[model samples]
Target chain A: MKRFIFLLCLFLPALSWAQLTIQIQKGADKPLSVAIVPLAWNGPSLPEDIASIVGSDLKRSGQFAPLPSGNMLSMPHEASEVVYRDWRALNVDWLVVGKIVPMQNGYTVQYELFDVINQRQVMLDREVGYNDSLRDVAHAISDKVYEKITGIRGIFSLKLLYVSALRDAQGQNTYRLMLSDADGAREQILRTQREPLMTPNWAPDGETIVYVSFETRRPAIYMENLRTRARQQLTNFPGINSSPTFSPDGRKLALVLSKDGNTEIYVMDVATRELTRLTNQIGIDTEPAWTTDGRSILFTSDRGGKPQIYKVSATGGNADRLTFDGTYNARPRAMPDGSGFVYVHRESGDFHIVLQDTKRGVTRPLTQASLDESPSVAPNSAMLIYATLYGGRGILAAVSVDAGSRYLMPSRFGDVREPAWSPFVDRR
Target chain B: MTYKNLGLSLGVVLAMALAGCSSNKAADSANQNGANSGLGSNSSSTFDPSANGNGSNLAQNGRIVYFGYDQATLSSDGQSVLDSNISALKSGSQHIRLEGHADERGTREYNLALGERRANAVLQYLVANGVSKARIETISYGKERPADVGHDESAWSKNRRVEIVLN
Candidate 1:
């Protein structure tokens, strides 16, 4: 009987190991861990650090948590120098390292990603070009790493358009509509005005932007093609034409207009310029944002006596209020999954970012910082970028939806406001 | 009285006028109290200028009008004053510039629209009262200038008004 029991115990262990193998084969497990070592630089101090930015782009996706450089046994600048044993000892599933070398036209950034456990180099890359191309190269590397690990595309190559404000001596307000890399590098100003310009939203294809500007001393919506620098004013209504947002398919624009006695939401056909009023109410209805499916819109209205989030069908219907916990909740940006939305919620008179689950009707406070506003979600729905006041200066900040990752993009110029996260850019 | 004392008193008067020139609070309060005094009402006499600190008095006495948040409609009180002001303007020969203003409630661009609405509301009333529209021109300062320094409700009520300036 004792001999039989001992054999059964040994056999039971083997049976459990077989079950674990089955589970692994069925893809029931966590993702592979990745470690990105700081890249080596051979050129003069770069205009902007590229490796750190790439690492941050990967980290914000929530799929990877970069290990600190101090934990690295040896920093490898080339694929030939990779010591897999060193990374294996640290239990790192993958390793990424590279070096930037000077080139005639610009710079060459050579990088490699290694599967430490497999003892093989997964990605060997060569990005050759100018200083302006470094950011794109970094994004490409990030894309490669992301695809190798998660089997999904990375949106790091996309660009974000935002509004930058400066007050001149003549008491004139100067607004510069700017476009920059997703990592906040390679900033290029698209338009400058002596009046207020706001709500810079990108087109679905990432080639154009639609925003509201007071260039003619009246609130009008304007669309500008980023490549050609051509612009067209969409609305020159007699009263309040503002808060323009593009539909998901880019065929129409959702905007606010008060020409018919009260401010209300309106949808304009991009091709025909025909207008259709969506909301007809006495209260102010503005700040329209389309749902991911483009079937409905979420906007702010004071019909409930205070500013709150309300949802109406894109085809027009009775509006439904979505927020109830706060006295003031505006700027509702829906997540990509249609699962929830993030918006500015007033708590104790200070505005902060809050996430609301649409299905469950549950709200979660994602930020505790004071005065965080204009929260926009990444195309992946993993992170949020918003404009907040830090040290009495306006700066752009990003925070994970789970409240784990946080970072700031402080502009060296004047105040930065109204940061619009671009949709996922398709890489050819 | 000696010339020196008279000159000193005159200097004091000039300083006061300069300081109060831009602020209508002092002048408005004085007028209200002077009206009460003419009725022989010393009972509430010590007349604290700050009692009607809210620009509501400006709207009630036909010197100004108030609008809703992001609105420029003439409230019943605002319409009553405009009704009387139309007759007064028709009798007088002075041309007026209707200066429009808005409270610090909405965005600057929206505020400009609100201010213009307030001015137009009054202009429309005057035109209906047989006053020539050409006699009045309108200008909107939006929320750039405030009649009261406070940021509370009373101050906002006072700031959202249209002042008819005789030119």
Candidate 2:
């Protein structure tokens, strides 16, 4: 049982604090103003601050601007003692107040949301969690509040998967596959190796993951179950074997292989290990990602002399180019609804993450960072996390899909890259 | 006399680094020398110009071949470097591995493919020049491993290269 946590901390050595510090770089031009008053404690002071955590979560989303607690005219823990005029005086459109009550083995956090503009109560909810799980409860509260206001699901409770490489004194590198909360807490390293690992992505089931590892001295695709810790190498081809992405249905894995002489896209049946080559081109055809319906695949190819996103039938067919605006576009991951995708777009020599809406035929860059790449959209499609260089070290940065909110999650040590946001897990 | 010994030690170290046999020390030397000796540099000679007369020195000169941005074709300078080491390559029966690499600019998976393309290009050149196809193997590290850690073009140009490692 003790060995369970060591795997989580193997690559992050000698660091007392391993959590990534979240720095909000930008927010929406006109963010909604909300006040989250500090929750009143009924018993001895708890370890976690529920209201503060919830407020930070909301603020990081870039849609809601959490008002400073110092500016709250009146602190109302319950709806019965509410005062709308006080919140209105501060120009706050929404109000949130909560209180903590210790239970037998855990605590219950009761919170209320009010519409300052209409002078009405929007919601009254309570969450119960143990001491160590208090942060999760806070995220759960934030999810509820955000969904109530935006009519879209919140990703506060989701997980993030990324790879961090730490170079030793000898300049040799050790790569670690890390799993953490969306806000960069509870970091658990699933795999660590001296060789390189890339293109880690979650299965739709949220219990398994696929990534390319050079552990065997060559590129190979590997699948690991997060619960049992069981590992299996899925592809061991002679040439390049990489870019393994699980299909939406979790049945087939779309990947790239150069076994037949050149880089090409292929799909492998997860159960039987059957292979289906999808793209046949002399040029490089790689980075296969499944569309929302799992009926077609989107991949990056240099068939047109420059890397561009192309779409092809999942079974097999001619691929049609999807991106026309950029001379260099690659690594396309479609949105949840198949309405749009996010990819690496090179404009004026700088690589930035851009979102393309297929339904509306509109494309926009979501980040201003010069070297941004590996954009992984959240389960809800509200935000995305990508790898970028900050202060000459690789760090994970996030941006809202609408380009409204921007934040940087810099690790305490080494370089973090290729962040894959997990799907919404059914906690029940 | 001490300078001769130092040169001998550096030659062994450079050989191991070029052969992909040594670890951190080799990578460190690659970083230190790649920028100076890389094809992107205006000066092509890595060591003393007078040392070019020796076979071992010619082999060392041909140990690395750099490429332009998003390019897999061998430049004239690259071809000349390989031509100098052809005698040493043909004389040895040892197998070789061409480790391809790319700078950290594009998507990693694409870079992996690009690196492979570059290695294949090198392999073709060697095979066409009389090296047996079976004697050479190729692997692309993509942008995962870099000859230099710097982010500037100077480092990137050095990183975007194929290393000829003799086993």
Candidate 3:
């Protein structure tokens, strides 16, 4: 009887390991190590692969590092086939294995997460969706897995808006405003013009965009509904009209207009078109960006003898200078957290993007590129996308705030500029 | 009413004759004394010389040249004035700085390049006219620096200028 009991104890652990239970811990000293095995599919080759897309999406977050197949100890297709001891030997805290089985009209995906330390199966998610929705499904799974581990919402479904310019013979320049996935996928042209388009900004709701256009032989601001494709001319003043920014609440727009005899900031109601002047200074007051709270706005002005950032109340009050370090500091875009602002700073005859900490009142250089301009921060404030000249051609590049990861998005048509990251879309 | 009208017309006629006589005398003095004597004095005491052409008021100081919209080509009138000023600087052997500016019509980055091109055009003109390129340096302020506060064509025309300053 004693010999049989010892044998039973040894077999019990092996049985538990095969079940592959995952435990979602509250916090860990470091980010949990996860290994995502390639999905096993028993069907005709699908138009899209979900496993590769999920891996790429998770890796782009910078918080999670997905292990490659070679580093993985065991490739498990089902929950019963997992070897917890192999994964624990590799120091992997979590292991994910999934399979795709073809259904009548679509495909059914079943995935399982295991906790190698506990030697048990923790969670399982199964869904039936179309093949064309594979990327979306992958993003959804990434969000779920990330939130389950990191305790913060993932911005996987957001979008980005940018403007591209192509100059042809006969001196005709074609400008296109494009909308694409946050990862630069599935791009669709929003508007096209033979003239120049500048300063594409997103509304708070993420469904509309405001920008400046020079189609009528003069610069004017316009707002377009992305879904309905309807455009309204926001400003048609006699003089210079540019730099349109939406307020946080989406009820108003703050912009620069020289029709009042000087380039001053103005707040106009989006519905009624009633105007209220904000600044009365005899300086070049342009590039107006609203604070996250919507109580004040930060803009670039030369009132202090050089172009620097100044903040004023949205309802018109005493303006306060915000930047004093560089000889040329302009294009202030407030971060989502309201803790800092990112703008182009010129030092030693080279322009770079720098982050200004509002609390410490100090600026830190973020990029060392020579001519990086027009930086827009992601909705999560983790990365910033901006335009730079690469090999004498304009291209868009993104870099993490810590300068750890960088990527480039070159346009297939022509040069791209003025990238605007949209806020997180409301997922209902 | 009759008295007020008579006084206004009389004031206008008297002002016109006085301005014409003073300009004639100023011209005669300029011919005899040369352009250097007129440098330190206010030229407004004589008739305004920029009334006919779109001459920038900046030229009254004899230290600036203006360009048309989106153009770097020097107008004939602007060239003649800059020629005389360049000759004076060459003869005086003075180091000069040329500050270029642009109107707020294009994007800021493009405007900066445009302003630099305009200033370089002026620099080339000066160098071809026997002025040493080493004696003149150029800095483009782009649209950051504007002399006129308005956004109209009148203001934009005045804002696009290259100011020559002696170092």
Clashes per candidate (backbone, < 3 Å):
0, 1, 8
Order the candidate numbers by lDDT, best to worst: 2, 1, 3
Tell me the lDDT of candidate 2: 0.83
Winner on DockQ (2 vs 3) = 2
Using all chains and alpha carbons, the TM-scores for the candidates as numbered come to 0.70, 0.88, 0.67
The candidate with the higher lDDT, 1 or 3, is: 1
CA RMSD for every model?
A: 17.8, 6.2, 20.3
Q: Highest TM-score, which number?
A: 2
Deviation of model 2 at A400, angstroms: 1.5
Model 1, position A228, has a per-residue lDDT of: 70
lDDT, model 3, position A42? 76
**Two-chain complex of model 2, DockQ on C-alpha atoms against the true structure:** 0.30
lDDT of 1 by residue, B16-109 (tens): 2323332344344433433333322222212112222222212224456667655677888778767755666676565655757886544333
Candidate 1 vs. true structure, TM-score: 0.70
| Full-model lDDT for every candidate | 0.69, 0.83, 0.68
lDDT of 2 at A226: 85
Of the two candidates 2 and 3, the one with more favorable lDDT, higher being better, is 2
* Chain B superposition TM-score per model: 0.64, 0.69, 0.63
Candidate whose DockQ is highest = 2
Which lDDT value does model 2 have at A146? 94
A245: Cα error in model 1, Å? 1.1
